[model samples]
Target: MLVEVKNLSYVYSEKTPFEKQALKDVSFVVDEGQSVGIVGATGSGKSTLVQHLNGLIRLKNGKITVLDIDLSAKKPDLKALRKGIGMLFQYPEYQLFADTVASDVMFGPLNFGFSKTEAEEAARRAVNMVGMDYDSVKDRSPLELSGGQKRRIAIAGVLAYRPKILILDEPTAGLDPAGKREMLSLIASLKGEEISTVITVSHNMDEIAEFSQRVLVMNNGKLLYDTTPSELFYRLDVEALGLSLPHTVRIVRLLKEKNIILPEVLTEKDLVAALLAYAGGRNA
Candidate 1:
């Protein structure tokens, strides 16, 4: 297992008038090579839950074991734990601070104890991994790049450390339609290559449906459902739970009304393939 959370619970402003529970008896396991999506409305504890995986949030009332490191232990090796996980928060591009791309991307490895030469080497590889030419952008300021390029460079910074688990929160936020698709494709390509597991928290149902193999639905800081994307999108009363269905799911439902039933599909490509097969079978 890459990560395991058992009976995890957390409260904000504990023992105060503003006390509010963020997670209640949450439990889940993320296995290696799994692409998991966490979905919920704003303030539903999606972010809070992920923060615990890398020791960003202190564990007060739960058990979490990630990569064989017990998070609830006294003085957990957070630095070591964080070194194996790369986290990109909402608008990760905003986290870029170094004057140059090389400097920014090299920071992670250097901070993790890599030598200067080694850090630069790692930075170069990470930049190429993110699809940017290291030679061309190494000395250039990140602020000079386009929005999408800036986002990729920011991701390269996290990739420099070569984390096994990658967690992205609102990764496609503030991007155009094409940018969103590009970002999703980039993340999809990263799976199983230096990143064995991916945990993404997105408010976009379409993204969650298309990208995730498994889905975790959170409601009011609680894990309401843990199921496949196909099952969650097809079988759940997601709308009633204040969650929107993917556009492809809606299209599938519409086709069903027209007597063209298709199997549960999460992406546009799958929907198209299913429709084609149905039409061909009828013609035969």
Candidate 2:
């Protein structure tokens, strides 16, 4: 297992009147090179759960082992653990602060003790990996770039150090459709590459179904379902858990209602192909 958790529980404002249990006995395991998508309604503890993966939130209760390191251990090397896990929170572009894009992206490598030359090279590679022109954006101020560009640069900053696990919270938030597609493509390309695991928390069911092989559904601070996207989305009770089916899946269901039998489809391209095949068979 690349990541494991058992009997995990957490509470916010433990002793205060506003105290609330944010997580309760959550447990799951992620294997290396697997892309997992976590989805939930607001306050479902999705964000709180991923935070524990890298030790950002102390393990007050339960056991979490990430990459064979016990996170529940006292005074574990959090700094060292974090070096192997990269987390990108919502609106990560706002975290950009360096004088230029290259400087911002190189900051992580430099802080990790890389020589300036090596750090610059890593930054160039990271930027290029995200489909950005390094020479064109290197000297430009991050603040001056468009929202989509800023997002890519912010992701590059995390990629510079080449973490083993990457966790993203709404990485495609606040972007146009085209920008969302570009970002999703970049994330998909990371699979089986330098990153060994990727976990994404997103509300976009289409993106989750399209990118992840497995899906986890959370509700009221508990994990309600963990299974393949096809299985989870096809369940009749999925909407009852506060998650809608993917657009393609919903369309397939509607077609079935009209007695037009079609196989499961999860993407626009697949839907088009299915429809074309159905038409051809009828014509034949």
Candidate 3:
């Protein structure tokens, strides 16, 4: 397993009025080079769970070990543990604070014991990999760039670390459709290139269907289901977690329900082709 969690639980502000349990007995294993999607409603503990992968949030009740480091303990080598787990938070672009894009992307490696030359080289490579123009855009202030560019630069920061496992929380959250599509493609390519484990947390079911091989549903700090996308999308309670079936699945199922003849359409592209055939057959 690439990552493991055993009976993990965490509460905020224990022994106080603001106390709340963020996770309860959440357990799952992610194999290396696999893409897993996490879905849940707001405050469902998705963010809290991924933070434990890098020892950011210490496991308060149970145990979480990533790359063989005990995150539940207080004295683990967190810096080393974090070095292997890269996280890109929601609206990561806001984290950029450097004078230039190149400097901003280089900050992470520089902080974690990389020489200036090596860190700069890594930053350049990451920026290019993320589809940024280093010669022109590298010197520009990140705040002055377009929305997609800023987002990419933020991702480049983590990519420079060259972590083995990548976790992104709502990577495409506030983007136009074109930008969202491009971002998702970039994310998928990362898995292909590095063979790294990826876990994406989001409420976008369409993205979940298109990207992940496994899906994990969370509700009220408990893992509701950990299964394949096809299995979970058909469940009636899927929307209870603030997620809905992919439009392709919904359309295909509705046609079958109405007794309209249709072939199996598993992917979005397949569904589009089926719909085209359905239209053509009717017209003919």
Candidate 4:
């Protein structure tokens, strides 16, 4: 297992008037080369949980061992831990502050002790990985790029360090339809090369259903479900847990209600193909 959490729990502002329990005895494991999706309504402790993987949120009342760093330690090797994990939060473009795209992308590797030359090389590779030409964007000020471009550059910054595990929070938020597809494709492409593992948190059920092999559903700061997307979306009453089915799944269910049964599908393309096959079979 690449990560292990046992009996994890956290209370925000302990003993204070505003104290609230954010996580309640949650536990899960993530292995290498797996794509995991985390889904939940707002304030569901989804963000709080993944933060512990990289030491962004302190481990106050839980046991978490990530990449063998032992996050439960009073003072864990955070610096070492970070080098193996890359995290991109919601609206990551807001985090960009360097004078140039090159500088921004190189920041992580440099901060992690890579020499200037090595950092630039990593930056160039990362920029290319995100489908941007390094020579074209390297000299431009990151603050001046378009929103979609800026988001890609921000992702490049995280990829520059070549983390073993990549964590994304609402990566498609604020993106146009085309930009969303591009972003998702870029993440999918990095599965086994630049990143060994992926953990994505999103409210978009369609994206989660299509992209994730495994799914983790959070409800009111608790691990409500740990299962595969096929099982969660197809076999479970997701809405009862305050979640919606993927649009494709919803369409299929609606057709079934109309006496047009089709195989349970999770993508738009598959849904269309299933409908066509059904129509052809009926005509025959």
TM-score, cand. 1 vs. native: 0.96
lDDT of 1 by residue, 1-284 (tens): 98999999999999999999999999999999999999988888999999999999999998999988999999999988999888999898888999999999999999999999999999999999988899999999999998889999999999999999999999999988777777888898898776889999998999888889999999999999999888887888988778898999999999889987889888889988998999899899
lDDT for each residue of candidate 4 in 86-128, tens digit (9 for 90 to 100) = 8999999999999999999999999999999999999999999
Q: Rank the candidates by TM-score, best first.
A: 4, 2, 1, 3
Tens digit of lDDT per residue, candidate 2, span 1-284?
88999989999999999999999999999988889999999999999999999888999999999878899888877777787889999999999999999999999999988999999999999999999999999999999988888999999999999999999999999998888888988898877786868999999998887888888889999988888888887764778888888999999999999999898877778989999999999999
What TM-score do all the candidates reach, one by one? 0.96, 0.97, 0.94, 0.98
Candidate 1: what lDDT?
0.92
Q: Which stretches of candidate 1 lie over 4 Å from their true place?
A: 278-284
> Which regions of candidate 2 deviate over 4 angstroms?
none
Where does candidate 3 clash, by residue pair? none
